[model samples]
Every structure is written in structure tokens, then in C-alpha cells.
Target chain A: MATGAEQAHGAAAPGMPQLDFTTFPNQIFWLVVTLVVIYLVLTRLAIPRIATVLAERRGTVANDLATAEELKLKAQEAEATYEKALADARAEAQKIVAEARAEINRDLDAANARAEAEIAARLAESETRIAAIRDTATENVRAVARETAVEVARAILPAAASDPAALVSAVDRRMEMEGGA
Target chain B: MAVEDGGGLSIKPMDQFIVKPLFRDIEPGSCMPPEIVEGCLKWYEPSNVTLWMGLGIVATLLLLVVGTRGRAIIPSRSQSMAELTYGFVHQMVEDVAGKDALKFFPYIMTLFMFILFANVLGLIPMSFTTTSHIAVTATMAIAVFVTVTAIGFVKNGAGFLKLFWVDAAPLALRPVLAVIELISYFVRPVSHSVRLAGAIMAGHAVMKVFAGFAAIALVAPLALGGMVAIYGLELLVAFIQAYVFTILTCVYLRDALHPSH
Candidate 1:
């Protein structure tokens, strides 16, 4: 009886539809659709924004670098100009100092020459005046001596001295004596 | 084994391997039965759906690969279409995954394209929806989950596990939160696969039922008109389901890659 029941519940034929997992074609189809749509969306809309933002950032950085370089160059130029100006001022000051020193030396030399010439003239004049005074004194003494000798001769020989020749001889003799001494 | 006198049909397990029941027998020796091939473990037999999917893949590849070749400052029509797709995916990745996670743009874009193409093709009367299959969708979701998980680990090493338990839960609720986190993490693949498959299956079943009605009511003009409208509506549904599935996949990937957001 069990055998008969098993035989009655036999399976269906080999050509019947079954419920196996047979959906590869469907899955592949949807996969293709998803890929295509996504590819389109990505290419068109999303990538450009990112690229733009990156490019903008790069540009800003480059601009900043350029500005910094320019400022540096300007600063260098200013420093060079300042150094040149300082050098020029120093040179001008040296030139003025040199000119003033030369002027002072010239004035000192002139003053020394003028003082020497004045001292030499005063010494020569004193020497000439002293010589003149000495000559005058000698002449006055000789005259006085001559006059006194003549006067003595005349008193000693009052009666005999009436002759002019005698008086003259006596005066001559006194002068000769005085000169020899 | 002949037909019964009462006209009853009998099915056997071995009959499932045959192709005649699923499709018309064009000619003797022309129609082939499904066979298991060695070294290529296939889960399903090749059906009309497979052929449609192959065609869709070929079409998408042609459009994407041949459409844009050289970069142009100003794009041509084909190039513009390609650019539009790239731009859309890029924005979606940026919006969902954040700027730091844009490195995964290529993978996300490819995923979206594959799913979108499969979904849209199903809208065609004779086309197949590959995403409708659980194996395909589950495989895709698993891949995404694995990749995101791997990325988190690779990026943060052991710290990636902290994504689950690092929250400041109340002292009494810490254990509860941990359980919830574990469950949600496990459920990711399940929800991801089911969402796509269920949407496709429901839409296809509805279309199939309506088509059956159209076939049966061959003599009624009013019924034919209603069938045509339903067909149009199914077409719309097919596109919408594809978009929904693709968008949701992107959202899930974003969450996985960047759990903080």
C-alpha cells in the first residue's frame, strides 16, 4: 500500500516551468541602466564644480606669492636707495671738512709771516736810532773838549795870545792830543 | 507519461531544467536546454532577460566609452551627455559623502550607472531587469558594504570599530545602544538588497498581471485601451524604481564610508 502511494505521487515531466533562480538577464539589464545614468550625471554636473574650486584655490595662492615677491623687490630697492643716499651724505661731509681744514692752515701761515716781518723792522729801527744817538754824544763831547782846551790856552797865555795864529796852534795841539788818546 | 483523459497537467522536478516550457520551441535541435557549466558556477539559466541585460550593457558601454574620447573645453553633444552624467554623480558623492570622501567617486559613479541602466531597461517591453534578481542585488550590496567597511578600517584601523560604540549613550542605555548598533550594521545588506529587488518584482508582477489581462480580453476594445494605459504607467514605474534603487544605494554607501555624517 505504501509503494502504491509513492508511485501515485510521481514528479512532473522534464519540460515543465520551474521556479529556479533564473534572472541573470534581468540583473544585467538593470546593471547597464544604472551605470549609464550615473555616468551621465557624474560627467555633466558634479566634476566641474570640484575642478573650479580647486583651480580658484590655486589661483589665489599664486597671486599671493606674486604679491609677496613684488613687495620684497620693492623693499630691496628702497634699501639700496637708502644706502646710496647715506654714502652720498658722508662724501659731502668729508669734502666740507677737508675744505675748512685747508682754509685754517692758510690763515695760520699768513699770521706767522706777518708777525716775523713786523719784529724784523722794529729791531732794525732801534739799532739805527741807537747808532745816531751814540754819534751825537761823541760829537758833543769832542766839541766841548776842543772848546775847553782853547779856553785854557787862552788864559795861560793872555798877553801872548793876542795873536790869532798862536791861539789856533794851541787849539790844534789839544785836539791832536785828544784824538791820539 | 501521456496527458490524462480529463486533461490534467503534471510537472516534474527534472522538467525545470528544460527550456521548452519557458519559451517557444522554434525548431528541432535549435532550442537548447539549460546546462550547468564547469568552473563557472551559475545560479540561474540564461533566459530572454539575460539577452536583454547583455544588450543594455553593450549599449551603455558604447555610449560611455565612445561618447567622450578627448577632453574638450567646449563639449560636443555626446560629450555633453557624458559630462552631464559625470557631473551629476560627482555632486551626489560630494553631497552625500562630503568633500573628503570624493576619492570614492569613481566606484560610486560606476555603481550608479550599472543599477540605473538595469532599472531603466526593465521599462522596455521585452527588456530584462538584472537588479530584480536577489543574487545580483545582494552581491552588489554586499560588495558595497564590504568596501565601505574595509575603507573605514583601512582609514582608521581599529578606530573604525569605534563608529558603533563611540556615542555618548546614557549609562543605563549604553548596552541597549550597542545592541541596536549591531543590529543596524547587520541589517544594512538585507535592507539594501530587498529594497531594489522588491521594487522591481512588484512593478514587473503588476505589469505581467495587466499583460495577462490584455491577452485574455482580446475581444474587448475598452479593456485593450485600459491595458495600453497600464503599460504606459508600468513604463514610468520601471524608470522610477531604477532611480530610487540607485539613489538609495548611494545614500547607504555614503553612510557606510562616513558614519559620523
Candidate 2:
């Protein structure tokens, strides 16, 4: 019967149907068929689909990584350019400050030199005028003294006959003595 | 085989492994004509083999085919399981065999899933373990063996014979070592098949014996506890056996692909 192998066969190891040789052919046949079918399913359909998903994921990841790298490089270049521009501006500002400071100092020095020369010239002129005035005043004083002395002599000495030449020589000799002292 | 002892309790421990026909009725001499018996022996006739094998296929398709039908980026539970299985086998095949051997990934994947599902399915109550039979395991093992041999010859031609030649041994011992190696090499498929079948058959038989002892009221508690423990162990064994079989296949494939002495 078809059921004979699936059914019980009397043996020493009574319940162990695995020892039965009768049912082997059927199990083996079906196992081959089942294994082949499963293999087909995996190769033709299931595994290929899985591989596709995996490969797609890998490709997307790699592409994303490449894009990220390019963007990073671009950011770095931008940062470098910004830093360069900043440095240039700072240098230019420093140069401008230095040049303006030098120009201001030159102008200030020129103004100070001009003012000192003018002040020196004014001081020399004032000294010259004062000397001239002193000279004039000294001359006037000497002349007045001489004239007063002569008039007084003429008015006081009416009895006595005065020697004019002797008087004049005496007055001259006195003036010379005072000037020498 | 039930035996009644002095206590009058009988147990048939080996009754579970029976391979009964699922459909045909051939009760001894009741079929007076020999033609019916001859008709029943035909290979194409469906039996318990068809039922269990069909169940394994159905389970595989449900998990793989239907579960992955959506192919969602965020997988459902069954889809996750399907992906996990795919990745696990894929990594194993790639790591154990070289990347070149991934060409045979489908075959290795099929074997792993089939054996794993078959072993797990056998754990159900009153279910027949297809892997427990030598016929089925032997067939798979022999197929692997033939495939590896054919690949070795096809890829390496006469150079494949160098795998048997032991240049590492001393000149005097080379022949002796070659003979020894050849025997063991030929014995690989036999051991591969028997290892799985024997382990599964032994576990089921031991559990059956324990379950049979559960009939005795005095020892029922102890027997049930033991059965539970053994059942747990069998679950672990089921997965380990499948892993062992698959890894060994990878090793053989590596040998065939690279067959250098």
C-alpha cells in the first residue's frame, strides 16, 4: 500500500521509522525537488532583489559622501578667501594710518620751524629799535646838561671875566673822563 | 513496541518515527491483487513526504516571497526576519568561502533555509522530521559532494588531483598519507549526512522515550520536566545542525575552488 511506508513497520527499534528503508525514495525525491525549487526562488527572485537594494544603498551613500566632500572643500576655499580679504583690509588700513601720521608730522614740523623763525626775527627787530632809542635819549641828556651848565655860568659870573676857551676845554675834559669811567 | 512490566504500564517510545502513507490504504492481505500493491510502490505517489515537504515550501514562500513582496525600506517583522536570514547567510558564505564563491550563494542559502525550517518544523507535536531520515540528508550531502567535485575538475582540470597529493609529507610517507587522505575525503559526504540525520533522530527518539515515561503517574512530573528540558535543548540543536551543515558546505566549496595542496 502507499500508506505502508508512512504507516508503522514492525521492527526492533519499534518507534524509530527513520530506520525504515521503504519510505526513503519518496523523501529523497521530494527533497531534491524542494531544494531545487527553493534554490530557484532565491536565485531568480528573492536574492537578486535584496542585492539590488543593497547595491542601491551603497551607491547612494557613496554619492552623498562625495557631495559632502566637495562642499567641505568649497567652504574651506571660501573661508580662505574671507581671511585673505580681511588681512588685506587690515594692512591697507595700517598703511593709510602710517602714511597720514607721517604727513601730519611733516606738516607740524614745517609749521613749528616757520613760527620759530618769525619769532626770532621779531625779537631781533625789537632789540634793534630799543638800542636806537637808548642812543637818542643819551645824546639828548648830554646836550641838555651842557647847555644848562653854560647858561648858569653866564648868569652867575657877572663880575668875573670868564675865559670861554678854558671853560669849553674843562667841560670837554669832564665829559671825556665820565665816559671813560 | 510496547512492553507491559510487573507494574502493568506499557510504553511505545519508538512509535513516533513511523513513515505512514498519507493517502493510500494497503492493509496486509486485504488487497488481494498484487497490481494495487505495485501501483502503490510507484515513485510519484504522494505520501507524508509530499505533505511535510509541501509545508516546508509554503513556510519558505510565506516568509520570503510574501513577506518581502512590499520590499519596504523600513521592514515589517516578517520582512525583517527575511532580511536577517538573507544577510546572515550572505555574510557566512562570503566570509567562509571567498567572494568569488558568492556565485553559489543561492544554493548555500537554499540549503540553510531548507534545513533550518525543516528542523524547526519537526519540533511541532506529531510532526515527522524530514531531516531525521538518512535518505533525504544523504541526498543533499551527495549533491554538495558532486557539485564540489565537478567544480574542482571544471575549474582546475587535472591540477585538481593535487589536492590528494601530500608534498608536505616526507618522500617515503607521501603514498601512505595520500591513501589516508583519499579515504577521509571520500568519507566527508557520508559523515556530513549522518551527522545531521543522527543528531536529529537521536534527539527526537530521546524526547519520545521521555514523553512515553510521562504516562506513569508516579514519574509523570519528572518525565514532563525532563521532556521540557530536552525539548529546549533540541531547539538549540536544530539551529546548530543547520549552521554546521551550511558552514561545512562552504568549507568544501572553498576546497574545490582553491584545491591547492
Highest DockQ: give the candidate number: 2
Candidate 1 residue lDDT tens string, B156-209: 677666667746777788677768887888798888887887777666655554
DockQ of 1: 0.07
Question: For model 1, what is the alpha-carbon lDDT of residue A72?
Answer: 100
Give the DockQ-based CAPRI class for model 2: incorrect
Q: Rate residue A114 of model 1 by lDDT.
A: 94
**Which segments of model 1 are wrong by more than 4 Å?**
A1-181, B1-50, B69-72, B166-168, B216-240
Candidate 2, residues B81-132: lDDT per residue as tens digits? 8888899989998998889999999999999989998899999988888898
Among all windows of 10 consecutive residues in model 1 chain B, the one with the lowest summed lDDT is: B12-21
> For candidate 1 chain A, which ten residues in a row score worst on lDDT?
A11-20
